[model samples]
Each structure stands twice: as structure tokens, then as C-alpha cells.
Target: MAAGTGGRGRRWVTAASPVLLPVASAGLVLTLWWGAVVAFDIPRILLPGPAEVVSELIRLRHRLWEQGLVTLTETVVGFGITTVAGLLLGSAIAASRIVDQATTPWLVAFNAVPKVALAPMLVVWLNLGMQPRIAMVVLVSFFPVVLATSAGLRSTPVELVELARSWDASRWRTFAKVRFPYALPQIFMGLKIAMPLALIGAVVGEFAGGNTGLAFVIRTASAGGNTALAFAAIVVLSLMGIGLFYAVVALERLLLPWVRAVTA
Candidate 1:
């Protein structure tokens, strides 16, 4: 019985290690940060300690929430648009050699252009407010989705396609039933890559010209010489990005349970 109990305890520890390890790592980093600040006697204005940043977080929680919401909206909306458009365009490109030949070069060229340089142009075209920000998110994130979708669809197994054709499956039926499902993993991989980019795009838009969002908060805080507040805003943005990325992961797991099972 004691041996069985020991085994169970070890299993429990192993099971919980994933969560515990990240928490411990984060704590260690924060401890190091705090110690460095204390040892160096860093000025609160130049490099506030972690405690100061946490205090700023609590003090300005409401303002952060409001700004964070704006950023979240821009990311979600832009990502959603990119997802739909990318899937459609990717499907088209995958389905037709002519479409692929005609569009691939243009898509590559557009993606190669510096996204940051386009932020100002987007602002000029869309005008101030969330429009440019959303556009920025879409622009920054669109390529990955399109590229992933096309690649995933094209990567669908030839054997599977032949089997479906032998079964007299219609093109749409084969795509819907076989190709799309098989491609979901790659497509989701792209989405995970794009999620952070979407947030960056939103922040870049805010940086270019905006009075709201976390980027704006950071800018204003730094301009006012409130380094702690700037750090706080940055922390919030990092957490938001992490949360959003995991949300996509959760979605992928939900939709592609088989992929996980196969990998496992």
C-alpha cells in the first residue's frame, strides 16, 4: 500500500509539474528583477522594481481594462477577418493552378513589404481611431493565415485524394470532408503565429496615431516619466498576448482532438 501511495504521489507531482514549472520560472525572473533593482538602487523613474509596477497595475486597473478592451477588440476583429479571407483565398489558390500562378507572386511581394512602414499609410487612408488599428492587425496577420492555409491544403495526402476520387466524391465533398479537416493542424499553426502579430499590429497602429489602447497607455506613461506605469502597461499587453495565443491553442485542441491524440 505504501509503495502504491508513493507511486500515486509521484504521478501527481509529474502531472502538476507543467503548471508549477512556469510559475516557478516566472517567480525566479521576478525575484532576479527585484534584486537587481535593489542592488543597483535603480531610480523609480528609470527602472522601477516589480513591486512598483504591480502597484501601478492595481492603482490604474480600471484605465488599463478600458484600454486593454480596445486593443482586444482590434485584435479579435482583425484576426477574424484575416482568418475568413485567408481561408477563402487559400482554398482558391489550392484548388486552381491558374489562381496559384497568378496570385502567389503578388501575395509574396505584399507580405515582403515592411508592415511597420504601411502602418502610417493605413492611418492616412483609414483616418484616426480603430479603423487603422484593425487594418494594421489584418495586414500584419493576413499573410501567415493565407500561407498556412494554402500549404496545408496542398499538403493533403495524394493517397487520400485518390481514394476520395475513386469513391466518386465531388470536389467540394472531398474538400469539406477530407482536405479541410486534414489541413486544420497547419491552419491552426498559422493562427497561433498570427495571434501575437495581430496584437503587435494593434499596438503599432496605436503608436502611429491613437489616444487609446495599451500602446497609447505605455506612450503616455513614458512621456510623463512614469516608468512604472509604462512597465505595467507592457506587462498587461504581454499577458493579453499570452492569453490570446492560448485561446487559439485551446480552440485547436477542441477542434482537432484527433491531431493531439495522434501526436500523443
Candidate 2:
């Protein structure tokens, strides 16, 4: 009886841990921040209290929402392109040794390039528009998805391939049935990494002074020394990242119920 109760307790703890830990950590951070603001009587110009940030967020919610949507749109557009292209390139690499060898050097070199430095060039190449921002998102995010997909596809067991061959399954048939399923989990892992990256890329493009999105709002607020408002914009960006990350997670759960059940 005691063992059974302990098992149930462990299960409950495991089930609750994800949500509880983050909430607790955020609460603790906010408490410390509020305490520091009061104890130091910190200048609002340098740092704003949590309350002030919240108030500013509320005051600017509409404008923030509009800007946020722009960021989200660019992020999604760019990320979608990244995912599709990554899957194609990854499949090619995984399927062909020659293709992998040929592409590796270029992929490594491109990945090594500091994407922030490309913002000005991207703007110059694409002109001063969301096109550059979306391109920025793709550049920053494409590598992970490609690497993950290639790894996952290549990781399919040799025995599975042999068995498929014995059964007279074509290469496409085997990949569709066996390889793709195995790759889904890793692809989603890449996606989680890519999603936040896409958002950051959008902001980076905006920092080049394109005049839209939360990045633009943040730049304006900071230039005017509205630290509270700037902090508020940052808060919105964090929420956006959190929201996007969880959305991908939820989609993963929905699509891969067996993966979730196995992991749990």
C-alpha cells in the first residue's frame, strides 16, 4: 500500500512539475525585483518596478498587440519557409552521401556567419521591408531543423531497412512508413529551437530601423528614456516567445500522442 501511494505521489509530482517549476521561478524573480526596487529606490530611468512595467503594459497593450502581430506574422512566414526547405535539404543529405559531403562545408560556413551582421546586407538586398525580416528569420532558424531532420532520418535502424527490403518495400515506401515516423520527434525538437530564433530574427531586422514590431517599439521607448515602457515591451516579447514555444509543444502532443505517452 505504501509503495503504491508513493508511486502515485511520484506520478503526480511528475505531472505537475513542468507548470509548477516555471511559475514558482517567475514568482520568485518578480518578488526579488519588487523588493530591490523598493529597497534601493531605484530610478525609473534605470529600472522600473514590476508594478510599473505591468501598468505600462496595460496602457500600451493595444499598440503592443499590433506590433506583436507584425512580429508574429514575420516569424511564422520565415519559420514556415525554414521548415519546408530544411526538410527537403535534410532528406537529400540523409539519402545521399555525396550530397551530404558537398553541402556540409557550405552549411557550416553559412551557420558560422553572424546573422546580426547580415541585417544591413539583407535590407540592402531585399530593400527596407518585411521581406528582409523574414529572410533574417529563415537564415537564423534553418540550420537546426535541417540538422535535426537529417540526423533523425539517418538514425533509422539498419535492421528495419533490411526487413523492409526483404518484404520488397520500395525505398520511398520504407521511408514513409519507418523513417519519417522516427524523424518526427527530432524534427519537432528542431522546431522548438527554430521558433524562438525566428522571433529574434524579426526583432533583429527591426533593429535595423524598419519601423514596426515590438523591436521598433522597444527602440522608441528606450530612445525616449521611457524605461518602464521599454521594460513593458520586453515583457510582451517574452510572452510572445513563451506563447510560441508552447504552441509548438501542444502541436507536438497532438500529432505525436505515442511519443508523449512513451516519454511520460
Candidate 3:
């Protein structure tokens, strides 16, 4: 009975650790931040204390919500576009040597260029609208999906391919049964990477030129020397990024329960 109880307790702890650990770590960080601000007499302009930032968050909650929605919409839309385009392109490259040879160099070269440099150009071409922001997100987030998908598809075991062929499976059947499943882990990895990149891309576009978004809030607040408000905006962005990342992780676990079991 005692052993069973102990086992259940351990399982409970394990289950709760994901939530508890982050909360504990955040508490510790906030405590340290508060202590440092109090000890050093840091000016609010230089570094607002956690309390001040929280207060600012409360003050601007509604505005922040609206801006956050705009940013989130841009990120989701852009990531959706990236996922579709990247998968199609990656699959083509992986399946055809001609496509791979023709496109790989260009992809490498384009990815090498700083995305920040492209943001202004997008704004110039598309104007200071949501189109440029979405475009920036696509440009920033598309490469990882393509890279991961192609690599994963290409890395499907030779034996598996042969086994599928031996069974007289059609090309599509083989891919659906074997290659795509094997590639899902990598594809999801690309998606996880792209989610944050999409958020960053939206922010970069906003910084380059925009009157909305959390990034815009941060930019305007900092420019106006409302350091606490800027910090508040940053906090909101951090929360948004964390939420999106975990959503991807949850989807991955849902689709690839076996992967999680193996890793665990």
C-alpha cells in the first residue's frame, strides 16, 4: 500500500512538474529582479521594477490586447502560408534530384541574407500595411520548414522503401504509410521553430514600419521614454511566444505519442 501510494505521489509530481517548474523559476527571477532594483536604487527609466511593469500592464491591458491580436493574426496567417509552401517545395526538392540541384543553392543564398534587411524592402514594395508584415513572417519562417521536411523525407530508411516496394505499394501509398510518418517528427520540429520565427518576423516588420502590434507598442513606448510600458509590452510578447511554442509542442505530442514515450 505504501509503495503504491509513493508511486502515485511520484507520478503526480512528474505530471505537475511542467507547470510548477516554470512558475517557480519565474518567481525566483522576479524576486531577484525586485531585490536588485531595491538594492541598487535603479531608476524606473533605466529598469522598472516588476511591480511597476505589472502596474503598467494593468493600465494598458485593453490596448495591449488589441495590438496582441493583430500580431497573433499576422503570425498565424504567415505560418499557415509558410507550412503549405514549405511542405510542397520541400517535397518536390526531396523527390526530384533536378529540383534539389536547381533550388538548393538559391535557397541557401536567400536564407543567408539578413531578414531585417528584407523587411524594409517588403514595406517599400507592399506598403506600410499588414501585407508586408505577413510577407516578412513568411520570409523569416519558411526556410526551416522546407529544410526539415526535405531532410526528414530524404532520410527515410532504404530498407523501409524497399519493403514498401516489395509489397507492390504505389508511390503515394508508400509515402503515406512510411515516409510521411517517419518525416512527421522533423516536420513538426520545423513547425516549432517556425512559430517563434513567425512572431519575430511580425515584430520586425512592425519595427520597420507599422502603427500597431506589441512591437509597435514597445517601439513607441521606448521612444517616448515610457520604459515601464515598453517592458510591459515585452512581457506580453514573451508570454505570447511561450504560449505559441507550447501549443506546437502539444500538437506534436498529440500526433506523435510514440515519440514522446520513447523520449520520456
lDDT of each: 0.95, 0.93, 0.95
Give the winner by lDDT: 1 or 2: 1
lDDT of 1 by residue, 1-264 (tens): 999999999999999997899899999999999999999998889999999999999999999999999999999999999999999999999999999999999999999998889888888999999999999999999999999999999999999999999999999999999999999999999999999999999999999997999999999999999999999999999999989999999999898888967895
Candidates ranked, most accurate by TM-score first:
3, 1, 2
After superposition, candidate 1 runs with Cα above 4 Å error: none
* Model 3: per-residue Cα lDDT over 32-146, one tens digit each: 9999999999998999999999999999999999999999999999999999999999999999999999999999999999999988899999998799999999999999999
* Comparing 2 and 3 on TM-score, the stronger one: 3
Per-residue lDDT value at 184 in model 3: 94
Where does candidate 2 have its weakest 10-residue lDDT segment?
255-264
lDDT of 2 by residue, 66-174 (tens): 9999989999999999999999999999999999999978999999999999999999999987999999999999999999999999999899989999999999999
The TM-score values for the models, in the order shown, are: 0.96, 0.93, 0.97
Give candidate 2's whole-model lDDT: 0.93
TM-score of candidate 3 on Cα atoms, chains taken together: 0.97
- Candidate 1 versus the native: TM-score? 0.96
Q: Give lDDT: candidate 2, residue 81.
A: 98
